[model samples]
Target: MTTKSSLNAAPRRFALINDRIITAPKEVVPVSVLRALASIAADQVLVRDHGSPNDMVLDDRATVDLNDGNVFYTRARCDATPPAACGSPAKLAFAVDDTFELSTAAELPFEAFMALFGLEAGKQLFRDFESPNDQPVAPGSVLRFKDGPVFYTRGGQHHDARVEITIDGVKHKVAPGKTSGADLKKIGNVPLADELIQNIGGKLTPLADDATLCIAGGEEFVSHPRCGASS
Candidate 1:
């Protein structure tokens, strides 16, 4: 159970691939390896453990893990002064059983990959899913083969996964679950007097401020000034 005081007292923090200051919803979270690495381009990432000498690398990942009460930084695995994509990408595709949703690059770090077959648990990433099973690879080892790192599950739990959404014309990631209309407004910072419109199947639908949304991921939203107050 999260309280406002809890969020205020301790905010889990990390930086986006664009270096945006992001607040984590949990103390420690598991992120999708495919998405994380893709956030950065041209190179692999090295994750420095929050206040320790240990470091982790991402072979194809551009994202980093978020830990509560800690801050982590990402670096490249290459010898280049600023780091650049030195190794070629390996094709990686993942799915819940056979319903593959995301197809991406390769040879990602172990810590970088999120499993139980879901990115994380609380956000309802995959229903009843735990974590990804252990593989023969080590955390620091590289598995850049040309084939598939493709994933599958026995009982499909690929419900609403985290997806990319557009708020006010800017793309943002939306975690799947019961969403409040206010939450969407906060995502795009829509004003109290403004309105949010959802474009679905080429149809324009006005979203209510009190509505609850079950996001299917990859949805688009637009904001505009309210025409008039509701009767």
Candidate 2:
């Protein structure tokens, strides 16, 4: 006769982030969430197969599979140039749901840029205005118009696609592609995104009620309704 297995099964191993090992029944978890679990900071955290070269750096979309031995290791990464340099290409890429996306490349076609914003190719897209320096993007490009600036319409108002940055207690709006050390200087004197994170004493995961939340797409700050104590 056949027998049924017990319902209380053991949790499966997911993947290792840094020295910590994560095990869960779920098949996948966002890299950002995993970094938080391992106490590692954002953007620079590199996840790779347990033992592999730097070329295998896993993006935010990497998944941990229990059946395939998808073990991983996480470490902070750095670029050789100083944060104050200008015209540097974005070094990382990430997606924000189906509404928006970002990628790291020296230069991409206008079609490629539109695709990131969920725009259809070969369509009569309505741009707010013609950019002055509109041209093919080059390697090591920043948010300059030569790299094909993106525009969007909201409530019949035109706007450029940009991100948020906080410097010395002041928040500023900046382009998402401009998170590099050089790109950040357009608004104010600020350290590299990674540098700021390191200076803040690594990833902030405290049991206190005044913890900070660092969201993806640069240093933007947003309020989470559930994060605060209710009245």
Candidate 3:
């Protein structure tokens, strides 16, 4: 029965529950609804697994906080299979600018994906972008099953085959995405004994030889001689 007090309660909230999503009704969620939303049975257990230190059981809880992303998992009450019986890790295959798709099993967030690939805000991920009616993928979305799924991206940021950077006032075009300081040095033909530095906001920042960098256009780099004044 709908009551005036319940209607006047706080707004409803959404949370990720065991590969599925659920919403709280007036800040208080019933267990039945939670299971229904998660496609789990009543006998299943909702666990908050973190580490060996402490793992809380969430089945007894009625309300979960929002504002911060809420994540929960559901497991069988009794497990006959061994720990090693778990299924294979999920794999997500994605590509940008109609490039070949690459698979990843890591639970990497969308922001990290953008940074690693030098993707900009305009770059958007979608399902079946080749089709007439394509669907847009929400940021931070995940595919949890062990089966590998593919997605596509389209945007101007991914259209560029190479990024143009200036090294010691010399312009060079290099592949976009993750790069190492050694690769930049090689591209600039800097002496092996010299150190590589990046120029940003008029400040010179040192770059490690093996350091991974997200290549972008118009980036300025300088090579400094390693030898210092002899005392």
Candidate 4:
């Protein structure tokens, strides 16, 4: 079983790409070649498709099925809704058996294409690449350092309380107000928590509301006892 402490210690990062394969040395390969390599099952592979405005293609994937002969892919698709369609891009995910291969139609080198797979993972990958300082926390988020990174939920809607911090150096998601207290305790060392709570209350606080603190882009509201309603 993978322990939280051990998992947090591992290194991972995120890289952005249009349609390419990212290699161990952090090189970008064409998407076609990446698809071919994935067909053969490469180790520790990540694939992503940063959609272009005119292309209308969606692809964002991450996978680690090398030795066993499995390929995984993810797609992040843009929604047709007004804001989502205009602002957000489309995404998708895919997984295939090792027997798969890049079709002859592809034009890029396999190595170059593989680089695109790791974009989302690249963010965490960058964290893993950099020396461990404080774990990356959103500006207005409160982070409680226990045996690992523990996120606490301020009172709101009742949701899953147990939260697990990823020690693998990979980024894990913890819903803003949905994580459980039991989850926070599992991280241990609850007393040593730190808060980046913003003064503004509510999910969408205007930047002018709190001059004392600046909010990060796309920050959701998280309520804390000491910080009140923060991002």
Alpha-carbon TM-score of each model against the true structure: 0.32, 0.27, 0.32, 0.19
- Model 4, 91-201: lDDT tens digits are 322111111122212222222222333222123211121221223322222211112211112222333322333312232333333223323222222232332222244
* lDDT of each residue in 1-231, candidate 2, tens digit only: 111111222222234444344443354566666666666666364544423233245566555433333344555666312223223332322111212233445344545555656644333322212221112222222322221223333221233344455644567653343133333332344432322321233453222122333323345322222334568
Residue ranges of candidate 2 with Cα displaced over 4 Å = 1-5, 8-10, 79-231
Q: Please list the Cα RMSD from the true structure of every candidate, rounded to 1 decimal place.
A: 16.5, 21.4, 17.7, 19.7
Model 1, range 21-132, lDDT digits (tens) per residue?
3333443444444234336444545443323333334334344333211223456547424433333222223333333322233344433444424543222222112211
Model 1: lowest-lDDT 10 consecutive positions = 127-136
Best by lDDT: 3
Q: Candidate 4, residue 199: CA error in Å?
A: 44
Report lDDT (CA) for all predictions.
0.44, 0.37, 0.53, 0.27
Candidate 3 residues 66-91, lDDT tens each?
Answer: 22223456667774222232133222
Quote the positional error of residue 162 for candidate 1 in Å. 1.9
Task: Give the poorly placed runs of model 3, Cα more than 4 Å off.
Answer: 1-160
Winner on lDDT between 2 and 3 is 3
- Output the worst ten-in-a-row residue range by lDDT, candidate 2: 1-10
lDDT of 2: 0.37
Worst-scoring 10-residue span by lDDT in model 3: 1-10
